[model samples]
Target: MQTQRNRRGYIQHFINCKHLWLNELKKLAHDLKNPYLLKENVPEYPRPEFHVSHLKHDTERGALCWIRTDGGFKDPHRGFRDPHKWSLVWWSLAVGPEEIKAAETRLLEKTYPNQTKEQAVKQQSFLWRFATSPAFSEKSRYGSYRFTFPLQDVLSAYSQQFCFGAPPIMRVFRTCLFKKKVQYSVLVHSPANRELFSEFPLLPGNDPNAVCAYRDGRFIWRSEAMCETHRY
Candidate 1:
């Protein structure tokens, strides 16, 4: 059995990163090498239970908010049925209200090439239904970002070059979040390389303001930070 202090420490660490704690627990289990002992001394914490409650509330509120704004069915199961749906919703939220309107306009023009302005507006509004639908906000069983490249050439170029020797490319969707007073990204990865990509420094250590590269597969998404010339 873990000591009380040890249990508290483990719980605190686990709160920071559940996967890391679980990994450490697995390692400990293997080192002990005794199933009977492992069963008797398993670490217990209330965080996972609390986390579920927090997640459920967030999911419900997010879903309801989307439904009220979009005039769509309020199906909570849709988020559960499709994992990408939640991320997409999160992504949509990340893009400020103005961007969403502009994106809708752009999509309408592209999707309805020959339609008149009035017809296209009607069609586009209908098309926007998918974007604001509960069907697209489903929480995924496997939590990660999903990327769908619209252009085949963009997909092909990245696949051949960047995906080699790297992890499986699951999904890639873009969103803006505030980090250090500027909008930073929170990306999900399939073959998640959290350590490798976490602090991807774009330039040498000397430059405080440098554009960073967030990489997955063959593509590198650049941050908005301006790159500084190297001062040798």
Candidate 2:
């Protein structure tokens, strides 16, 4: 009962914040469209197939490494030659809400201590959805960045934000699927605005210092030019 009540409280926060579709969601939250008390059964742990360790971090990890951004905007859902890549990597499991809260605490105080309080709140909000939602896609598919950060944390706090809307923006953090061992950073529902597709520019863009021309047959970036190249 308390969990159900808490979920309602969380949903209500959206209402107070004037979320665009809160009216439809508020009705659904109250059992107007579905049973408000219904819960979905979830496995205690993910199956072997879902293990993130098996993911390919040893090789390329499917990145256009020369481009400063993660693999390009290759989400096939956007149609051919989209050129816009996602900045987020979210993993999901059916953990209890309490576990989610503990994860939030552990991540903020220990994992991402450098972020400001405001940035930390945004990270926690994204983590909440990552732990509870069952919508994460497999990490290796559709082009994603892996092993881009140290084991302790994901992306930096000062990461940029892109918005299709006028001013409001959501910052995306880089999370790898593997570190010393498997981290299981599954891809969850990214906060994307389709209308922003053509407008919002994704990718860190190509720095002339770090271009990878396919020499002969294989893709390669000249390492000898390291002194010349400042960033990736």
Candidate 3:
């Protein structure tokens, strides 16, 4: 238990740095935060049979990381392997579920601006139903965080240029899945359901958004906004 606590402390200190934002693994370790970050993961074990938290209670919790795989399908449109890779869905666990619902409403209206009021409202609710479930909220071990983003979702993007300043501002939907075995990493930008860019051969810009990205047109990826971003 002491070892676990110490590890969490080490991770927390490293994650709080903006200078290492470009380091993918460290970036994700930071974004997911602690507690769960310390406990989540069972790569050696297969699906539905992995570790699960036995504890259960009715209370708001922290953000949960939802991971999904794509049967190793090959993407034909890009020169990168990440777009065709696995993804993680960042969903609310116990923290401010109400606020999340409200944000979903706004995103619905923005995404489907031309839809009728009724359609937009329904869409927002629909997104909320699946996106914010408390599946693993009370798990004393692993929560229901094995959520997947579809193949069409561009949750992450690549930037060839390495930025010198702080990391980009992360959105609420953005989360990560750390592959300890590989020690390499990928970021899952849930809004687009794709990587911010591909790793095949990144263009220069230092800015993740400025470089030529696979899913560049989205509003969140458009503005030069980033988090400390949320905690650098």
Candidate 4:
């Protein structure tokens, strides 16, 4: 499809401009804390994805990159089940939430008949509640909220957020996804580079062991478990 080609072109552009973004990429790789997370000399184009956040009451722009893997395991799934396993990196910029809110708001205004400020706010509230509620939480399901943010709008927001604005070159140190209940992860810094960031406070936004999960319209992010109990 033309859209796929255009996105691929974006990746090519990223490769062409690697000099401008490589440091940022290294920063992200360092934050992973998993030395084996990235295979050597493997840089893939990052694809933008849309993520909805009930906590922020807005949608967000995030990215996914498929890279080669190095880790191995006994179980096929436990190991790098797919080529994109260990090298798979998903990240959202720290500034993504705010920008996405602005973009979504702008989109809502242009797509439908103009509404008074009060009406618009009320509708947004309804959409959030409807989308997050148990009955209609699934994003693929049809719903009125779907009209508020279409694929076109999401892609437009992605362009404005990344292409026109600063790209999410830095990895959010600690990222979380929410499922039914909010799950939090223990704070951890990579021993690999602890000396470099030793003075930094350990927080979800900057912790390197963090992994992202998505379930029931929620994202739970957690970092390395220092102990056996913490693993549970």
Candidate 5:
């Protein structure tokens, strides 16, 4: 009876071991078949060639850098083609207010045209959306203006101007209340969703109108007349 009991115990132990081994083998086979299951095979670093660049200032969350890809800013009618390469790199720099002001002046002078009467109206209307919106008022004491650009166009422009090395494009959007206090904002987009521009809060009771300002690209606001009222 003792010998029979020992044999039965050994058989049960052997069966359990075999079952365990088979289960492990099945798992190994499944993993091998699905290579994506191995994290090591995945890319650890972000690939910049196909991403957008989003950088912000260290001191002011409002200050931003929107570096366009090579050949991104040219007119499409001028035989512009999408590079299909998108990459985004972000960095922060600590700078003084004067430096920020100087940079803003330079960028505006270089990129934005003189504000026309129509343009002024458009901006005011845009600003009014934030001022009038109850939702905006509840969020915070300040407001921001956000700009969105087509990534392909920006990159194309960057490539043509700077062949080997180029300084990143940094644009500042400033909104003020009572012409005394200013709120800052930055423009940003992700590599995964480069097709659409993100939304930011505008002034309250502003009409939804799209206006292309010669000085500041295209701005979509509530209406031309409302924008004019808010002009300084």
Candidate 6:
């Protein structure tokens, strides 16, 4: 009886923490203050905007990184293709207050992997996910999963260019995914700094062989190879 009661207590505590984390996450996402320059380039569709938060200044123990996105089926266009089968991805960075604190330490370890001189110095994992439940199981229908690291990881590469004076503003990288002879499109999220991305190739506008599209969207890529790696 005592063990059963302890188990019930633990589960309740987990549920409470989850609720608190999610509430804080939503507040951070909707509190947009700056003008998002990249939103104007994309085709206006009702897609969920992804968010990240860091209470690095806070003394609180349960600070977290929250992500809102869709999982499986390759990309966002797949979700649009089958709205009824779309799955929402949501999860806290850590399971409990103790783990939440450890998560920050893990972030440091992830960012600077050369800390331990004994091990092979290399880039640690990026674009990784962790979940409190078995939602990502092979046969499961649930699709909630959260990226384990903060949004800073995504902005780190263009840190010098995009984040020198102010917090980097994320923009969309319009992408064309060609898989199984069917072409689909979705916005690739990135910092809005044009200098870093302007030189790279973009998906052609109207004409696949257009020499240079002047009024066309800024940064684009026909991700044919990328599409082969995942299901459409």
Best by lDDT: 1
Local accuracy of candidate 1 as per-residue lDDT tens digits, 50-84? 00000111234555566569653334454444323
Clash pairs (backbone) in predicted model 6: none
lDDT of 2 by residue, 1-232 (tens): 0121121122112111111221234344454323321223322331111111111221243344543374423333333221223443232232234434554565456655687878766752434333322223224332455433321121122122332223322221121111111111211122455344333232222332322222222122211111111221
Q: Give the TM-score of candidate 5.
A: 0.16
List TM-score per model, in order: 0.21, 0.21, 0.25, 0.20, 0.16, 0.19
lDDT of 2 at 62: 33
lDDT-based ranking, best first?
1, 4, 3, 2, 6, 5
lDDT of 4 by residue, 103-190 (tens): 3465466666667878886764212211232322334222222223332343345446445632212122322211111112222223
**Candidate 3 ranges beyond 4 A from true positions:** 1-13, 19-94, 122-124, 132-232
Worst 10 residues of 6 by lDDT: 11-20
Candidate 3 local lDDT, 1-232, one digit each (tens): 0111121123212221112222344335454553333443313210111111111222122323111143222223233322334333222222234433554565555666788867764652432333222332233323333333222232222221222222333322221222221111213322232255433232222354331122332211111111101111
Q: What TM-score does structure 1 among the candidates reach?
A: 0.21
| Decoy 4 TM-score against native | 0.20
Best by TM-score: 3
Among all windows of 10 consecutive residues in model 2, the one with the lowest summed lDDT is 46-55
What are the root-mean-square deviations of the candidates from the true structure over C-alphas? 22.3, 19.4, 19.5, 20.1, 25.9, 22.4
Count of backbone collisions in candidate 2: 2
lDDT per residue (tens digit) for residues 14-33 in model 5: 11101122223235434334
Q: Clash totals for all models, in order? A: 12, 2, 32, 8, 43, 0
Off by over 4 Å in 4: 1-81, 84-86, 92-104, 118-124, 133-232
Local lDDT at 55 for model 5 = 19
Which wins on TM-score, candidate 1 or candidate 3? Answer: 3
User: How many residue-pair clashes does candidate 5 contain?
Assistant: 43
Model 2 residue 181 CA deviation in Å: 30
